[model samples]
Structure formats: structure tokens, C-alpha cells
Target chain A: MVNEQGYNVALVGATGAVGHKMLETLERKKFPIKQLTLLSSSRSAGKKINFKGEEYTVQEATPESFEGIQIALFSAGGSVSKSLAHEAVARGAVVIDNTSAFRMDENVPLVVPEVNEEDIAKHNGIIANPNCSTIQMVAALKPIQAKFGMSRVIVSTYQAVSGAGNLAIDELKDQSQAFLNGEDMEANLLPVSGDKKHYPIAFNALPQIDVFQENGYTYEEMKMINETKKIMHAPGLPVAATCVRLPFFTSHAESVYVEVADENVTVKDIQSALVNADGIILEDDPSTQTYPTPLSASGKSEVFVGRVRKDLDNAKGFHLWVVSDNLLKGAAWNSVQIAESLIKNNWL
Target chain B: MVNEQGYNVALVGATGAVGHKMLETLERKKFPIKQLTLLSSSRSAGKKINFKGEEYTVQEATPESFEGIQIALFSAGGSVSKSLAHEAVARGAVVIDNTSAFRMDENVPLVVPEVNEEDIAKHNGIIANPNCSTIQMVAALKPIQAKFGMSRVIVSTYQAVSGAGNLAIDELKDQSQAFLNGEDMEANLLPVSGDKKHYPIAFNALPQIDVFQENGYTYEEMKMINETKKIMHAPGLPVAATCVRLPFFTSHAESVYVEVADENVTVKDIQSALVNADGIILEDDPSTQTYPTPLSASGKSEVFVGRVRKDLDNAKGFHLWVVSDNLLKGAAWNSVQIAESLIKNNWL
Candidate 1:
């Protein structure tokens, strides 16, 4: 299958939300592909997905599915990635997993192309995509950390339901309809699908994103805290997060406060640094009433930064508003970008 | 009207949102009222509102409206408050203003009864009510500050549309309906009614609240910062805020980070302090998955505090989730409390 034309690529979880985005991103970017294979769990097997007007049948994932595959993208779930990622990697295929399965693995490299693309070369056939919230946040902070040097980062996220998966989006829609009709909403999946005591997300905000960990912080908060440290290679950096799920359908917005190493840094200095950063689009100008909103940033690939301001009392403290499409730059696109980097750099 | 039976009360802007709540709260609490005068702008002057099954017609407010008024509660626009508050005071009526016109005035007392009942005695006839966002935050922080002492405070607010008034509440509902129907939304009065641009707030979050100031912070954010210091009597306290408007219709929630002066203070200590404090409700129990949400905290007169946890990296820093009804505890209830304090202390 890989004789000469191009590399063989397979997409697992092809029928899910982020998986659908992966297929579309591949077709839109015209990624080099000699043969395209689609894989999913048994529940979604035999499903049909079309890319570039070509219908493809999704097959159940198995160990032998990656026999001749040169690259594989995984987005099904943590257990699927844990079981199949190693099998795909053992068969000479590079696995770019979109779950938290291998992110903290000592041998696995957690990659955000805009932040840590160079780490792609050191991956031993498996690179983990960071969390959606962490991806946008680290992308915005990369330039600031590089130019001014960062000591502390405190972020509070206004995240979307889509990050919880396609079912959560449906829940939001159903709850909104019920709310408008003055009926009690039936809640099944929200705040966390695995957690108990579900609450409605229509016209409301839930402070807990993922399940609460032992330390009172949710797992989503921990992901942002740990992934930022690992991606930036600053394990000692002080990072804290409070992740809250809002009623939006897509795009996650963050209010971030960072303390720069240099005390003389100003808001203009930070804005100018982010203006030319890759994968970052600076939209801050209070005079023109310009800033990024979740609706405006939906379906966009670039991380939009705005509301840049200096903390009134602290010379080194500054605040930023960062927004990006959760499915694109946060998951599917980041995974694809890593694969693209691997091919371009001859690292695979 | 000043006979031994009761006192005459004038409710300015009585047909408006907060004004309507003020009237309901006055009637609900069975305040001593020999006579009630409902006042509004020229447009809403002829409207009729019922208090205790008695309908009163709203009259156009003027300088002479306060001639026989023992207490005047002003919930009109800041300009109206600026133009009429002093006139009410000059006619021997103690003015309880719920607008921002006199909040920062050194001669006036910005009162949150639980935190600063003594400040009511210092009022030069006009006792200003703090901004809705500030009122809940300071009330939550008052107990913590009293026990451990606070050196710094940083807050990010998730505000409701009702804080912007009744039209903004209507905008939220209309936009949510439009969003569900797959139609375009019309936003003419949000983020700030007087701001340059309006964005759809249905299923979205806007970081800007009120108009932008010279610095990147909004006037709403500035009010929280300045008002917190004045009401706490800690002029040197370092406070910063990022105010955001969400699509919800009631109850404002805040994610607050405070640096307690005592390094050994723990989450339990703070929770215990709040459990016994006046006008504070402690709803924190991570094991039971209990915390406050906008829908859960709506229509409540007490500030709900929960999600108390210590910062993972800082021993002196703690985080809290504070929620309260924007129209009740944040505005109407606080104003009525000030009047009760004035009456109890014989300051009127």
C-alpha cells in the first residue's frame, strides 16, 4: 500500500466529533495519502463517512489494522488509545493520540505544534496531543513566556459543551429548549459524563468541568496545569487553573493572568510580541472595541488573543483573553499538525 | 406623613427592573410605610405597579418629589441619581442610592450592612449601594478577611444579564430562542447598554462589561476594584477584577483568589468562618458534589459561598466560588438593609 506514491494513513474514531474533523482537515489540507483507512469501535463500525465526495466504510479497529499504515490518529477514548496506540506503534506506524492516555508517559512526547513542535523528533512512534483548553492557552502564552519569561500563570476557562463530546452538545440543545418552554430539563451528561449528580447547562455555568480529583481540583484543571508545564518544559513553573463549563457549543475562552519575570514589561510589549507569533492572532484594541468572542472564534484554527491589560497594582502581572475552536486547534488540527511536522522534518 | 404610625418612602425608577425588586422587597419585609410614592422617567411615568394589592401610578420624578419623603431609594440611571440624589438629601430624606453615581464619592457612605454597618452612621444623607458584583464579593470576603486578614484579592466574575437591567434579560431570552431556531440574533443592549458595540450573548460570554476605561479594564471592573477597597476600609488593599457578562438572567458567580495574611490558614478555617458569618451561606462539600450555580443561587438573599480550596503551590492563597442573586443581595436587599440599619441606629 505504501510502495511509492505517498504514506498510508488511518483515522480511528472516524465517526465521532473530533474524528469527523480529522477527516475533513485531512481532505482540506490535501495531506499526502496513498491509502486512507477509517477505524472505529464496534458500535460505530459499518458506518459511512464521506470525504472529498468519496464514501468510505468505517471498519472495527483491530491490532492488524495498522499492518501497512505509516501514520495513525486516535481520538476514540482513553481506553481505546491505551489498548490500540501501542499496537499501531509496534507495527511501524506513528501514533498521535488525542486522549490523555499517553500524555504523561515518560517516553511519550506531548506535542502542541505551535509550542513544542521540536519535541516531535524525539517521539518513539507516539505523540500525545494536549487538552483543548491547554492547547489554546499554551499557544497564547508561548510567545509571552519566550519574550518576557513567565513565573506564574493563573487561568479560568469558559469552555464549551462540545469539548465534552457530541452527546454533551445534544444535551445543551435539549436543555435550552426545555428552559425556554419553562419545563424542567432532564440531565444525563454534563459537568462530567462519568461523574454523578448531573446538572443542566442551559443558560447556566457549572464550576466543575471534569470529575473532582482528590485535591478538590477537577481533572480538567489538572490537565491544564500539568500539560502547560510539560509542553513548555518548565515543570517548576507555578500554574493554576479553574476550568468551568459554560452553555456554549464550541470554542473555549480563557481569562489568563501571568506574572512575567521582568517587572518593566508593559501591555504594549506583550501585545507586540503576540502580534507576530505563529498560530496566534492578536485582536486587542479597546479603542476600536476589538476582542475575540467564542462565537467569532468558532470554526477558526488560529488562537485569538485580546483584552490584553496590565494588572493595576502588580508591575509584573498582566491579563489576557484567549479563545479558539475546541475541536480544531485544540484536538483534530493539533493532531494533524503533529503528523505534518513529522513528515516534513523526516522524523517518522 | 411623619406621624408616629410610619414614614413616607419614595421609590425612584419604580417601574424599572431593580426598582420593581425594591418595591417587592419593601412590601415583602413589611417596611413601615405610611405612604408610597412611585417615581420614574417621563416615558414610564404612567405605569401602574402593585404593592400589597394596592396599585400605585408611577409619577415623573422631580426636585419637589422628595418634599415629604422620609426615605428615597434611587435605582434610576446614574445620571438621574446624580441629578436627584442630592435634592432628596437637601429635603431631609436619607437617600439610599443603588446606582454608581455616588458610590465613590468620599462624602457618601458605600454600605454593605454585614461588612460596614458603622459606615451608615458616617453617611452625609446619601448611603450608596455597592455595584452588584462588588456587593457579593465583599460580603464573601468580609468573613475571610476578619478571620485571616487579606493582603490581596483577584476576582473574575460570571455575571447575569439582569445586572444590565430588564431589557438585557429580554435580549438573552430572545437570542437564545433565535439561536435554537437557526436564525440570526439581534443584540442592541448588552455587554454595556452604552458601549459602542453589542454582541450576541446567547450561549456565549463577553469579557467586556460596562464601557472600557482608559486602561483596558472596564468601568465595571474598576467599580469592583475601587468599591472593594472603600467598603472594606482598607484603602491600601490590592484588588483586581475581570468582569464578564454571560447569558444567564440572574445570580452572579465569582471565582475569587485571595492571599490571606496568615500563612497557615486552611480551607476549613475559611469555610468555618463563612458558616457562622451573617448574610453568608456555605455550600461547599466536594465529597457530596455540592457547589453553587446561577440557577441554584437565584432568588436568594444571602451570598452563597462554596468550592473552598487551597492553592496547590501557595500556602497563603485560597480560592472561593461566590454566588448571589444580582437583584436581591446585590442590589435590592442591600439597599433595604442600609435603610433598616439607618432606622435601627437612629441615623435617619
Candidate 2:
């Protein structure tokens, strides 16, 4: 199905949440695609999806599925990426993975287009998109890092259920309705689906996001800490995160505390740095109560930064509220942007 | 109606959210109330409430209402407290004001019974109950400060709508139902009802909890910062707060970062400090996914501390997740505890 006008692209996990957003982002961005092959797990195969006024059948993804593909966007899961990303890469496709499988891989480049677009060129057949929480934090941090040298970061996240995937969104909806009705809210997919316990995410806050590591930090917290340094290329940055899942459905909001190396950086300087940044929208104005909330930034691709304030005690420290749609700039659009960069720069 | 046994008590704002909780707490704690006077604004007057199988009608509060009141508990708005608190004190009633009207007053002692119970003795006719978010944090931090010698604190709050009182809670319920039913979520009160703009708290997070100060920090954020210092009696403590309102109905959860003066403290040391602390329940065990969440901590009078971890980069720093019922330990119980302390210590 390869055509002469554009590159043939294969989208893995086309039936899932991030995958669905990827398709919409590609269609909205008018991504140059000659042949679009939708791939999913065996369970979701044969489903019909319409894109750009054309119906396409989702096929089961195997090694052979990437035969003539020029670009593959993998978001099925970490295990799927581990098994098939290399198969796709070896068969002559640049893989932009949307899982944690290759994010910390020494050879793979962890990329956020707004933070580290040039890292896309250094990929050895595969590029890794950072975690949803990490992506938005770095997008906001990069502008500040560029304007003033950064030192430390401490973030506490108010994350949405959608970052956990489609089931979590359904669970939040079901549980919320159940809670409103004075019924016992059933919990099967929250805090972590694979973890030993399940807690209600409706009208509650779960401090644990992913499974806990040996150091007592959740994998989601570690992802935010590790991937932030990797994408920003600040290996020694002292980043700490406490990831808490709130009942919201879409956008993830982080209360970030950063200490810049420059002691003279004021609130205005931080606001000015974010105002003209590529994919950042500075919505901070205390006088007007202008700031981004989950509902306000749900469908937006740009990272919204607001509530900028200098630390009362530390001259070099500043606090910011950063929010972005986890599915858009955090995952799907970032993946597609990496693909666009690959083609535009002839990195493929 | 005055009796010979126990102190004569006046309950202001008896029809409001915190006021209702205060009644329950007084009844549950078996506080020695010889006579109870229910008072509210003119709008809420004429309402009836039951206590210990007795029905009492609320009256409009005036200076005369506190004629024989030995102790007055105030949970009304700040304007009401500002107008009537002095009048109650002038009538020989020791006022325990839950509003922010006198929290920063140099003459008024800001007391968190667990942290600064002795400060209640220094009250000049009025004792200020610290903010809900501040009460839980200082309750968790006091033990750490006692054992480890605290230095700096940074907190990001996951606050509930109940902190805004009854109307805000109703807004959340109505808006959440509307959002689920695919109708428009109306917003009349949230992120400070008195503020110019109103944001929906249904399935959303609002970073502003109170009116913005000139320094760009919300009044709630400033309350956390300044009130924590006063309650902990550490005025020089470098405290910063980002107070965010979430969709939950009770229990304010805080992600706190603190640096102890002792650099060699381990996670166990921090756990040990919290394990035996008064009014604190340590619920940290990452292996079993044990942590304190808003729902788990809701309706509890004790502050729940969990997810305790040593900072990877800072030898002297630690992080904690703290949660408590905003109406109980954060408001009603704390006020009642102060009254009990006053009675026990003969401070009144």
C-alpha cells in the first residue's frame, strides 16, 4: 500500500486511548501519510476506523506488519514494544515508542519535541516518548532552564485517570456515578491495575500511581524523576516527584517547585520565559485569577503554566502550576511530532 | 437556660458545614457544655438543630448573645468573626475563631493542640485555629521537627471542596452530576467564593484556594505558609505552599518536602518520628501498597502520614504524604481540643 507521494506509517495500539489520540492528532496536523496501516492486539483486530474520510481495517500486529513501513508509532504496551519495536526497526521503520520499555534504554533517545527535539536524530532506529507526567513538566521546565540555569525540582502531581488508559477512565466514570448514587463504588483498575490492591479513584485521591519500586517511590514517580533528567539532558538534576491520581479524566496538573541556579530570577522572569516558548502558554495572572485547570486544558496540546511565584524564603526558588492534556502533548501529538521531525530532517 | 455544671458554650455559624461538624465533635467528645447557645447570621437564624436529643433553635448572633458565654467557638465567615469575635471576648468569652480574621494577629495565639498546645495559654481572649491544610501538616511536621530538627518545608496540597463550606460542596455535587449527565456544569462558588471569577470544581483542579495576595500567593497558600510557622513556633522556617483545590469532598492531602537539620536521618528515622507522634497515624508501607489517601483518611480525627521517602539527592531531606479530615482534625476537633486544653490547664 506504499504510495509515491508520502511515507507509509504504521500505528500500533490503534484501539487504545493514546493510540486513538495519535490518529486524531495525525489527521488534525495533516501529517503526510501515503499509506496508513492501523495495527492492534489480536483482541482488537479487524475493527474498522475512519481516518481522513477513508475506512481502514485494524490488523493484528506481527513482525510482518512492518514490512514496508517507513515509520511505526508503538503505544500498545511496554511488553508489546519490547517484542515488536525491534522487529519493526530491523524491517526498515523508525519506531517512536509511547511506552516505558525503551525510555531508560541506554541506546534509545527519550524525547519531548518541545524540550529535546534534536535528540530525535540520535535515535538508533527507535525513539522513546517520555511518560505523560514527565512530558508536561519538562515542557514547562525547558523554557525556565533555557532562560535561567536550573538546579532542583520538587513536584506533586494531580494526575487524571486517563493517563492510566481507557479502563481507568471508565472506572472513574462508573465509580463516580456509583458514589453519587450512594452505592458501593467498585474498584478494579486504579492506583495500579496490576498491583495487588485496587482503590477507588472517584471522589478520592490515590497517592500511588504505578507500582512501588524498592526505594518506596511509585514507578510513575520514578518515571517523572528519571525521564525529566533524561529528556532535559540534566543527568544530575535533583528531581523529586509525588504522583497522586485525582478523579479528573483528562489533563494532568503538577505543582512544581524549582530552584534556578541564578539567584536573581524573579517571577516576571519566569513568566517571561514561558510566554514566548514554543509549546507553552503562560496563563498566570493573580489579579484576574487566570490559571489553567484540568477541564480548561483537557483538549489543548500546549502546556499551560500558571500561578508563578517566587519562593518566600529561597531567592532562587519558584513555584509553578503546569497542566496539559495527557493524551495530546504528553503522548500522541508528541509521538507524531517526533515522526514529523524525522521526515523533515531526513533522520529516517 | 444556664446550668451550674460545666462551661456555658456559644456555637457561632451553627448551620454551616464546619459548624455542623463542630456539633458532632462536641457531642462525640462529650465536651462539658452546661448550656449551649446556637448562633448564626440573620439568614441562617431560625434553623433548628438537635444535640443529645434536645432541639435548639439558632438565633442571630449579636454582642448580647455572648452575655454569659464562657467559651465561644466561631466557624462563620471571616467578616462575621472580625465583627463579633471581639464582642464575644469583651463579654468574657474566650473565642476560638476558626476564620482567618485573627489568625495573623500578633495578640491572638494560633494553636494546633498537638503542635503548640502551650500557646493556647497565652491567648489574649481569643485563640485562632490554624487553617485546615496547616493543621494536618504541622501535626505531621511537629514530631519530625521535635526529633530531627527541621529546617525547610515545601508543601503542595490536594484540598477538598468542603474546605470552602456547604455551598461549595453543593456546587461540586451538582456540577459533578451535571458533568456525568452531559449537561453544563454550573459554577457559582469555588477557588474562593468572594473572588471575581468562579471555576468548576467538578472533575477539575483549581490552584487558587483563596483570594490572591499582592505577592501572587493565594490567601490560602499564605495561610499555609504563615500559619505553619506560627503554629510550629518556627517563624524563621522556610515554608512555601501551593494550595490546590481538587474534586474530593473531605480530607485535605498534602505532599510535603522537608529538610531536617540532621543530615544522617534515614527513612526509618522519619518513620520512627511519626510512628509515636500524638494525633498522627503512620500508614506507610510501599511493599504492600499501604498509604494514606483522601478517602482512607476521611472521617478520621488523626492526621495520616504515608509514602515517607528519603530524598535521593538531598541527604538531609525527606518527603511525606499527609492526609486528614479537613472538618475534623483540620477544623472542629482542633477547636474542641483547644477548649478541652483550656479547661484542663485552667488557661481560661
Instruction: List model 1 lDDT by residue over B79-196, tens digit each.
Output: 9999999899899999999999999999999999999999999888999999999999999999999989999998888999999899999999999999999999999988778778
lDDT of 1 by residue, A284-333 (tens): 98887799999999988899999999999999999899999999999999
> What does TM-score give for chain A of every model?
0.98, 0.98
- List ranges where model 2 is wrong by over 4 Å: A1-4, B1-4
- Write model 2 residue lDDT over A1-348, tens digit each, in one string: 323498899999999999999999999998989899999999999999999999999999999999999999999999999999999999999999999999999899999888888988789999999999999999999989988999999999999999999999999999999999999999998989898999999999999988999999989999999999999899999999999999999999999999999888889889989998999999988889999999999888999999999999999999999999999999999899898888877888
In order, the interface RMSDs are: 0.8, 0.5
For candidate 2, give the lDDT of residue A27: 90
DockQ scores of all models, one per candidate: 0.79, 0.92
